[model samples]
Target: MTAAAPRPLPEWTASAVSPLDAKLGLELLEVSPERAVGRAPVAGNTQPFGLWHGGASCVLAESLGSLAAHAHALTLDLVAVGVDLNATHHRSAREGWVTGTATALRLGRTLASYEVVLTGDDGQRLCTARLTCSLVPPRR
Candidate 1:
């Protein structure tokens, strides 16, 4: 007997993958088990003070991290669900775009972890986040 091949991951599209992501203007540029990249505009995702909303950063971080974990989980015919997320906003962005890069910290049989960095268009670090997801069989 031979090991079965991993299932092909569905193509990630802003509108198709998540409604919140589409509303927040998030775009996934790349995705893999070890890494994922995404970006969102800061124009509408701002606080009352007109600065980039910290919550938006967290959303992007979790999205990328979860996507990467899901990619890994697919290899085992499992699904990934977010278990924990933590984010620290270091700076604020008033305009332009924010890019998030998620780097896998651990890819395991039961869980996956990633460190996500959100950067401004100027290449300045704006936020750092960590996310963990649990892998399990998909519910029928």
Candidate 2:
């Protein structure tokens, strides 16, 4: 992650979860220093109703925000935990991978906030999510 670039949240880390848990195959492709950008296939992320699930969006949002917060605490040796999150479904995603961009709204010493927008293959908004993370202090 470049200092000038945005950062990725902690939950985006490969170490945080197993491949099986990445049902949507959300790949954390870019961490610009304070933002997390990723992509996940619609097929795996969608629900039985054939649209992307709201919970899936929330998972992505929380992951991105948490990862960014964790990165922020690296200097002090800590992690991050999701405290609050909200997701608004704008449209359904049915046939392709969706791009998600997580932008940090706040990155404080004890807490962090991020807004994640998931766009369909055609670049239409599928969901808008916001998340907060509480920095976990290191164990002494």
Candidate 3:
């Protein structure tokens, strides 16, 4: 049998998919599980006040969990869409790019849920997020 073709992920789904990381100045990285092994830097995603913005943390969390959901759906050729998302900031990163990792709590046929935790360079908690996505039939 021939090898299966590599699947296509959304621009938001792939690693380093940004067309202008330099312009955005984000050294984005993606990792799975929340055990602290999977954390990506935020680079320039900080507020002018010198602390990590809530939106920035949200993006990082969403990116990771969505990736997991999509990858999970790929097994069945399903398309995943984020239906609901939530985040709780436990602390702040005053300097340096923060890293956030996601852990999957549920991966079902119709929905997948993941939890993301962000930490500062000093290894302090910055934020925590939860994302839920719906897996639907893929378009032909």
Candidate 4:
């Protein structure tokens, strides 16, 4: 028998909102099962020292990775929840926006993992992160 065709990626809607994302001013550029891209400004997300907060970088990383994994799970009529996340801060950003890109490392039936990279406006790597998510059936 022929295998079934894969389901298409879900389209993101303006009404689909995340309060934390909105609070952080995250602007999503692209999202799919393969990757997710987004950006957040450093102006308000910085620490008292005026440098970008490492937590902000982790937030961006987790957002991208989680979104990508969720997109992958949707294809199977499932949902994803982050189980573990880790990040390494390499540099700092004092101004402008930091862009984050998350690429899938593994997309499996029960788990998904993604590598997320955060870069400054000048393309300098600011942080590297990895997120692992568990996929399960959505609550009825």
Query: If scored against the real structure, what TM-score would every candidate get?
Result: 0.90, 0.82, 0.74, 0.90
Candidate 2 residue lDDT tens string, 47-138 = 78987887877777776666666776675567777888888888887788878888988888788788889898899888888888888877
Tens-digit lDDT track for model 4 on 21-105? 8878998887888898889999999999999999999888998898899889988999989999999999999999999999999
By TM-score, rank the candidates, best first. 4, 1, 2, 3
lDDT of 3 by residue, 1-88 (tens): 9977534433544453344333334443433322112344454666778667788777767766776777778776897788988999
Colliding pairs, model 4: none
- Candidate 1 local lDDT, 62-103, one digit each (tens): 999999998899899999999999998899999999999999
* Pairs in steric clash, model 3: none
Q: Could you tell me how far off, in angstroms, the CA of residue 132 lies in candidate 4 after the best superposition?
A: 0.4
lDDT of 2 at 89: 89
* Candidate 3 lDDT: 0.68
Misplaced by over 4 Å in model 1 are 1-16
User: Model 1, residue 78: what's the lDDT?
Assistant: 98
Q: What is the C-alpha lDDT of each candidate?
A: 0.90, 0.75, 0.68, 0.90
lDDT of 1 at 79: 91
Q: How displaced is residue 76 in candidate 2, in Å?
A: 3.2
